[model samples]
Target: MKKTLLSLLAVVTCAYSAPALASGGTEAPPHVHWEFSGPFGTYDRAALQRGLKIYREVCSSCHAVKHLAFRNLTDLGYNEEQVKAIAAEYTVTDGPDEDGEMFERPARPSDRFPSPYPNENAAKAANGVAPPDLSLIVKARHHGANHVFGILTGYEEAPEDHPLADGQHWNKYMPGHVIAMAKPLSNGQVTYEDGTIETVEQYAQDVAQFLAWASEPDLEARKRFGISALIFLAVFAGVMYRLKKAVWKDVH
Candidate 1:
């Protein structure tokens, strides 16, 4: 026990003394109070629809959501007919007929969202850096939606002392404060159907929430199951407690 205590103390001392490897230039991402944050939270369908519009009209040019299918839009309060119409807006490559030739067709509800660039090389050639797939980005990083929201709204001018690399933009929330992508959102960038204010912050929050949904499509169902399981466990525990009390009461 003495040796174990000493060893544990030594380890704790080492951990405290060790230098953390960190990017010194970046600031922590700003936190947003999201509607779908907690276990019982649910998504606002109106915000999600607006977010989809932002992605389709603005972010789609450079970013791609290959993991998302057109049918998934139904979760954003879109009906079958509306989803089909939205899907038809994009053209997707299709297989050959009897001739075994590839063809292009209007994307169907079943089709995955088309990538903006054909390949990584193509994306790099076009954008100088490969644009990341947004399908799971909100869940991919620490702080999830809050981090993404910060990135979208964090652009600013660099101070004179800090020089940014060519093609790199200063993003307050980005590690090293240098990001390849410029600020994507602006005031009035997306006119919401529900007449929500069109500010960069609003756009960022909505889009981040939408990305979170994409990352966890079954979040609501999963939470429901968790609640049901907890209830079942509680009932089981009560029954077990009662049985124990009844069996042991006479002896005690």
Candidate 2:
């Protein structure tokens, strides 16, 4: 335990002390910093929608969201009809015949979304890398939002002058940060219907938020319950105090 703690401390110290630069500059780039700011505070409907769009268009090519059901879209503020329409967009496998052949059908509220690749090996073969399953990625990954933002925006080619780390490749911030994946987003990658330019950084932020929220769909309900519990307790206490005083006055 002592050795592990010391090693962690040393790594953290190095990471902090090393001259870290954000993508496109010598300075660290702006990222969406996450914190516990109530349930509603963390949610931005627009960001979630945009993130969904990015996931559908870009990251879905590699990652699978196996844990999420099509019905869960309602939690993200989509109405049932909207959720149904969205679910219908994806094809899910169905039916068990005597020959046991698989068939593709439109996604339903009950069906889980199908992955782009059949498995990790297939994903690697197709994309030159294994696309990660994003079921609970926001919850599972370390320093999630920061990591996501950093990885998405941080893709600089290593300079010949800089020394490379053993496993590292040419990355924007670190030397030899050879990320297997190519930069998915650049400026003007997605031409939004509203004319908003889809920059890589923006997509990163939105998708991170979406994944974070998807991992915790009960966030809004949890917040609401917490608030209600506090209010109920306060009101009950007030009523109890008044009742005790009234009963004691008659006795006195």
Best by lDDT: 1
Off-target runs (Cα >4 Å) in candidate 1 are 1-20
Candidate 1 local lDDT, residue 68: 100
Q: What is the TM-score of each candidate against the true structure?
A: 0.91, 0.73
User: Which consecutive 10 residues in model 2 have the weakest lDDT in total?
Assistant: 21-30
Per-residue alpha-carbon lDDT of model 1 for 113-196, expressed as tens digits?
999999999999988889899999987886699889989988999978989878889888887778899898889867787879
Runs in model 2 lying further than 4 Å from the true structure: 1-36, 39-42, 127-129, 161-169, 172-178, 236-252
lDDT of each: 0.89, 0.74
lDDT of 1 at 116: 93
lDDT per residue as tens, model 2, 186-205: 87776566555578877888
lDDT score, residue 91, model 2?
Answer: 91
